[model samples]
Target: MTLLSIAGGIVDDSALSSMASNASTRKTFIDSSITIGGPYNFHGLDLDWEFSSTTTDMSNLVFRSLSYPAEAMENNLDWITVMAFDIGAPTWKPNLTEAPAALYNPFSEVSGDSEISSWIRAGFPARKIVFGLPYYGYAWKLKDANNHGFLAPANGADITADGALGYTHIRNRIIGQGGAITAFNYTFASDYCYNGTTWVGYDDVKSILAKILYAKGKGLLGYFTWRVGLDDNWTLSKTV
Candidate 1:
């Protein structure tokens, strides 16, 4: 089956009509295994932890959208993708053993996934909610003597096409240069590499697979990613 999670921005009238036309024109495309999905960004929400907050809202919104008439939500779309991440450093201290605390403390003491699962169960069709498994992790600078800390972007550091390094461009450089990657067991699934000076953290196949299993156990539809191309090695897809 070929599940197609339509990005959320395609919900407009013109876009919907365009999609319907495309669906009719493509004879080679099998309708089976096809599902439409929505987009939710962790960085775009109001919750203490963007990841958990966005998932909660996304699950609810998708359920409502799916229940709407075909004119609003294409009938061919059968699922929605909720973006989830594996980093807790920005919102809480990186605790290898204990779950990180939420910044907003909604449902005090709730773990990230627990909050997300609860929201998903509240309204979304459990079988039609696809969780997003990230292929990267955030790198945070350990607190220094100056008491300052730094965070790595969840999307990996941004990189120039020419491969110049910026605050956000270093991680990609290391990965592209064939640096040795290392995995560390923490409350959040995290992996890191060293450039002989700075430490970089991100996600990999094992971490992504763990998220897929978590979604499956929650009776979710399946998994999705922001984009499939970043994982050039296909390790993430193989795990799925």
Candidate 2:
């Protein structure tokens, strides 16, 4: 099905707020969208309203009152896609290295598993949830070559992709370059490799399969990747 994705910038929040607050405006906006998309044969629309700070803004968007918010989601939508990646990165916290999309974090509740559990507790059904995997990773410049591991001391974000690297680039420039030691952590369900002072954390075939198994075991509907083009020769996509 063709889905029209509507991405709004920070400046558009006020317009969304205005539309949500007024039923007439909301209908006009949605009707106009449908009219425009009819010729394109679009099946659905996806709204990516980046931020909704207030509860009222959220309630307005869902056409529900604060008391019955979960009910609104259950009735108004087919399923929810959870972005289980981008949990941490050197750009956000440069003191130490981190997993960009860790499945489990033993030390804390900041993980994909934890986030899924939170959604379940928030009244979203497991069968209606879809897990997300990343086809990209972050690169960190290690302070010491020997200290290349999760939470290891790091100089800062590496030069590649401004601390981010697609799977294709990671596989080609680093892993394919030879001598890059690749390691997978079963505990976190993540993959990382280091070549001298350059350390890259990303998901590989093993990690991707592990996450798929986890999603299946959890009774999730399915899984999706952030972008298909970033895959290393469709390796990650084929695995899923």
Candidate 3:
């Protein structure tokens, strides 16, 4: 089933309007989502809810609006790809432009309250919400190399491409160049590198496999990567 993925991905008021209870909520989402193949023609929809840590998200708005039409239009959406990354340090710093944090750990303080959880709490089907794992990691300059705790203070950004180091870059460039690439507290299900000044926390084959195993145990819908080009060859993908 070739599903069309909606970009500018946020369940905004316009999208919520699809659930306005007045009329055409399904048509709105379907119209905006599928143009190449009319509503009934396409296989399904893939809700790409990105940048969604708004503290307020919904499913009733979409479920109530899309439920009936979903069946009629045969739009039993392929699955939802939740952007479950970018978890900053434990403490929120207003001035810090960037910080070090696990790119895909679900156990974080805010991970539970974000995309997947919010949607499910709002009543979206768990079996249809495929989890998202970042193929990249965020970098930050450590302020106190001595006290590198979960929420340790950071000097500034890590100054990498987009302030994020991809699996390819991390594996080929960072790992052996400065320091050994190693896993953090094993139980944490993440990896990191501290080459004196730069501290990078990202996912490697071990961590990604662990996450995939964890997802399988939970009966998650499936897995999806942020981008195919980010991984080193097929290291992460094949491992997962």
* lDDT values, one for every candidate: 0.42, 0.85, 0.59
- Ordering by TM-score: 2, 3, 1
Cα shift from native, residue 211, model 2 (Å): 1.3
Candidate 2 per-residue lDDT over residues 1-240, each given as its tens digit = 567767543357887788878789989989988988888999878676766667888777874544435556877887777788888788786768888899999977898999888877878788988898999999999999999989999988996545989999999989998999999988888999999999999999988999999999999999878789999888999899
For residues 52-76, what per-residue lDDT tens digits would candidate 1 score against the true structure?
1233333333323322332223343
Regions more than 4 Å wrong, model 2: 8-21, 63-68
Model 1 residue-pair collision total: 6
Candidate numbers sorted by lDDT from highest down: 2, 3, 1
Please provide, for model 3 over 1-240, each residue's C-alpha lDDT reduced to its tens digit, 9 standing for 90 to 100: 566666454357544433444446656655666665574676766555443332233343334342223332224454566666666532344223222324333444555125555666565666776777778876667776654434556765565634577878887787857565454646455677666656676777776777688667656798777777998888888887
RMSD of 1: 10.9
Assess candidate 3 and give its lDDT.
Answer: 0.59
Better of 1 and 3 by lDDT: 3
Per lDDT, the best of the predicted structures is: 2
lDDT of 1 at 116: 56
TM-scores across all candidates? 0.47, 0.90, 0.68
* Per-residue lDDT value at 201 in model 3: 69
Higher-TM-score candidate of 1 and 3: 3
